[model samples]
Target: MRSVAAVLVVLGAAGATGALAQTPAPASPVPALDERVVVTGTAAPVSAGAVGRTLAIVTADDLQRLPVASVTDALRLLPGVWVRQRGPFGSQTDISIRGASFGQTLVLIDGVRVNDPQTGHHNGDLPVALEDIARIELLAGAGSSLHGADAVGGVINIITRREASAPTARLAAGQYDLVQGAVAWRPATMGVFQGASASVDRSSGFAPARDFVHQQVRADFRFGRTTLAVSHLDKDFGAAGYYGPAPSQEWTTQTLVAARHQRPLTGAWSVTGDAWYRTHGDEFLYDPRVLGARANEHRTHVVGGGLRVGGRLSSSLRLTTGVEATGDWLRSWSLGDREEARVSGFGELEARVGRLLLYPSARVDAYTTFGSAFSPSLAVALPVRPRVKWRASVGKAFRVPTFTERFYTDPNHRANEALRPEQGWTADTGLDTYLGGTWVATVTGFVRRERDVIDWVRPDATVRWRTENIRDVRSHGFEAFARGQAGPLALGAQYTFTRVETDRLAGLSKYVDDYAPHGVGGDVSLALPWRLSTAARLEHRRPYGREAWTTVDLRVSRPIRRVTAFVEMANVGDAQYQEIRGVAMPGRWARAGITVK
Candidate 1:
């Protein structure tokens, strides 16, 4: 099957060029390869067209064209990234990078860590309002050298509302009684200028059991060289018993405010610093019969700050160093847990000589309630040829045990306070080749080895769950993407292959890994005249021991002056399957919407 798929892909490419000498190929609309340069993945930014790993950048224009309601849904389209969906309304999304668990992935909003130290689950609950997003930069594989900690898998940096040269306001409405409105004011100032934005969204949802209502607000102010911002969000939904036997209900609210400043000390020297505070609260209620003891409430608070400085030591030597400290305090009334705090700091340096770039970074963390630990990383990228680049990196990263891992006690599982943090080392290598004005391709292979993997183990014949550190586990994967823009058309495709190995579990018979089987996907888009555009996506996944399924999605957009009309068709092929456990995904859903800017 794999061979057949590969052959078909090759044939398709050939057909796009010209099948035979008898027929002339149609003029392609895709842009030239020189335009594919990317800036991400390594300590020093490199163009996707130059060399490095498989990095994908989601531009503001891309966000405007797609018909997505949540950020998690948008992330699924990226190469080597997975979104574990618990429900349709963005209830609980577990994002995994390069097959790493949720906790191993680090998320940043304007360089601020949003991954709650309390639990990996809340990492996806992004504190920032999505409507205020300007751009999303995703770098796959270990990024501990550039970023610190929780980077075992990858890094996703979400750039929030920044100073724009123009002012913009947008209002949108969609099916399911969904309504959205946003406004932003940007001056023609260069830097250290003030800009602000605000957005709101609400939906009645599509499923009978799923309904959600949410509102988000954000504001930003800048004076001289300093900027301060604050955002608040509230989400209340009806989750009809998706987690337990009977219908369950949950409400979540989170607030975050941050302040940052940037200044230049002297020639070739600059300093930047930022501080943030966040609070999250979750309330859950389960059906009386099935949820025996699942109902509970949880809240968390996190505060931290960091400072970075950059300078040039010599003509060929450049260095960047930084120190960061974060402290977390979480309390759960329902679980009778009081407080858990951790503080951490890190430093990094980068040096470039000729065609080679080297980066080394280290971080040390101290937990007031736990122990202290250290993580170090190193990476190098070299230009093998004018159009070809080679890169590799090795890093150590860790994830602090979550509150649920240490305190939660329920009918199905019992928490263990002695749980230890999960630590891992990642090694990766890749090649990026630019084919002049034709095309650019990137390929990467990586392996992640983790010890003290936290998981639930069956303790008795009753199949009860108990928190324990698995002996050891490993995950290996490879990802590839080729992008080219020719004339009025853009063509791109990404493929990922992963394999996981672990000791067989001793439990009740018949347990599956609960992950997609064979994940491969690609997309194609066309830019037509008169401000019209069209796009298509082909996605395929095979679950363990189950027949693989393929689905196609289609989208069309047209702009008329200050207003745009968009139509989206999900699961155009009407394929039947489930992306997550016990959750039935929608099939062949259609939505039409409009946005005024």
Candidate 2:
């Protein structure tokens, strides 16, 4: 295994040079970003034009032009984000943000929490089809402040396509006989509007058990002051022997419905009410006898409302304040009759003076299944010079036990309802700088200390694993990012270093022995003068208990009239590696296709 890994690393490096030579010239410069929203961190709204984080804006043009088979492919351009694909098609994706555990990250779809209430580990199995996405916002940091709850590491908000003024249809065909199609339309009157979209995708086997089928639909309508949306996603995936057993097939289904109403109050105040319902299903197996048949199903019902009122305190100062209320109920079939619910209320305040902004927020979580607690956070951003800025934040966050951790039961795992909630405090300081007109750099360092950390514990080989809380674990990390445009070509790269440790471990002296470390990656894209574009990417990561590996990928495309043709190479050198342990991923593969925009 070590020899195979080494050979792939060398091959990946050599292929980078060859891929660059075959790429196109370069495209025009990325526009000076404006209209970028900063809803992920500070309590108040911050635009990309005002704040300095390693923010990368990918426009609709960028999304449409890429030769992407899935949404994860489009996210590769952002710094501090890495993806591991198990096969040629989008069977499984392991995305890590800022070297944080996958379960620590939170994913939101149009303000609705997509993270499974049973286990955070299943959040990445987003059912929404990639073709339905309008835009994606990636906030790479501990976003416990603005988002509340599960956003300990980062937040990924996916915005779905809304009602457009025109109708559109897209059809695509690719390698391995892959086929996909999408159609959408919108029609509206003075007080009534309706929009809908449907899409389907399928592919032949690239490796054993690598075939997949996906279908999705979204429908929305607006009448008067009320709006409603309903969406569905279904996928059947053959994971092959990647997860230790051949014919390891998994199927997933998701359904969502949301409704909202908005009304203007006195002066600048606006009151809004929102509610949503979600259902998810998952089925997977290793072998019929050893692993047995496992199926998990969950449903969530959420309702909430909030009021926001803002006005000018003075010419230079702006004051914005709001209060919100939310209630959520979760039910799981795998939990053996267990149920959970939470009701929360929050308040926030923001103030700005000169080139500085400060925000403070507080929340009170009242749970029906567990006890309640109060959480608070504070943040500040200041521009020291025209080209430099400094920002810092301090906050407190907590994580409640999931249903799978407290009530689920299996032959290999047992539930522990006595588990205590995990609590933590985190702080970070960062600086952003722009040099000349060709380079931008950002550096950030953060430290987090958590108590009552939860982990699955095993007493002996004969006993089933159970959830337990361990005391005193600390983690710290730093990230450096830079992007530059030399002439017509755009280049960018980022590096991350992290250390995590627990004091309760017996043999290991430090927690760093178990955490991810030394993550470095870079991505570059160029657009030629002849309407042809090309992009290349490289990722090198070495985590604890694993061998280091580097991956190279490329994409090339040309447009003729309204049709665009392109080819994508993933793991161009066919690196054999694992993002998740015990999973043996496939080697080099390519997909070629064309799309009508």
lDDT of each: 0.67, 0.64
lDDT of 1 by residue, 1-597 (tens): 223323433443343233223333223211222344343454333344333334666655555545455666667667777777666546666777876777778988777777876667778776554456776778776666566667777888887766463666666565667676666666666455466666666667666656677666677777777888877767776666456555566777778888989898889888888799988888877763463666577888888887877777786565766766766677777566556555556655656544455667777777776687687766655555445556666677777777777887777767788988778777766766677654667777777777887776774658657777764767777788775567767666778887766666765312224444357877777877888999887778776556788878788989888777878877888787666656666667666666665
What is the RMSD of candidate 1? Answer: 7.6
| TM-scores of the candidates in the order shown | 0.86, 0.83
TM-score of candidate 2 against the unseen true structure: 0.83
| Model 1 weakest 10-residue run by lDDT | 24-33
- Indicate the residue-level lDDT of 193 in model 1: 45
Q: How accurate is candidate 2 locally (lDDT)?
A: 0.64
Candidate 2: worst 10 consecutive residues by lDDT?
Answer: 24-33
**Which stretches of candidate 1 lie above 4 Å from their native place?**
1-54, 129-131, 165-175, 187-193, 288-295, 435-440, 459-461, 508-512, 529-531, 545-547
lDDT over C-alpha atoms for residue 414 of model 1: 79
**What is the model-wide C-alpha lDDT for candidate 1?**
0.67
92-122: candidate 2 lDDT, tens digit per residue: 6656666555555677777667776666545
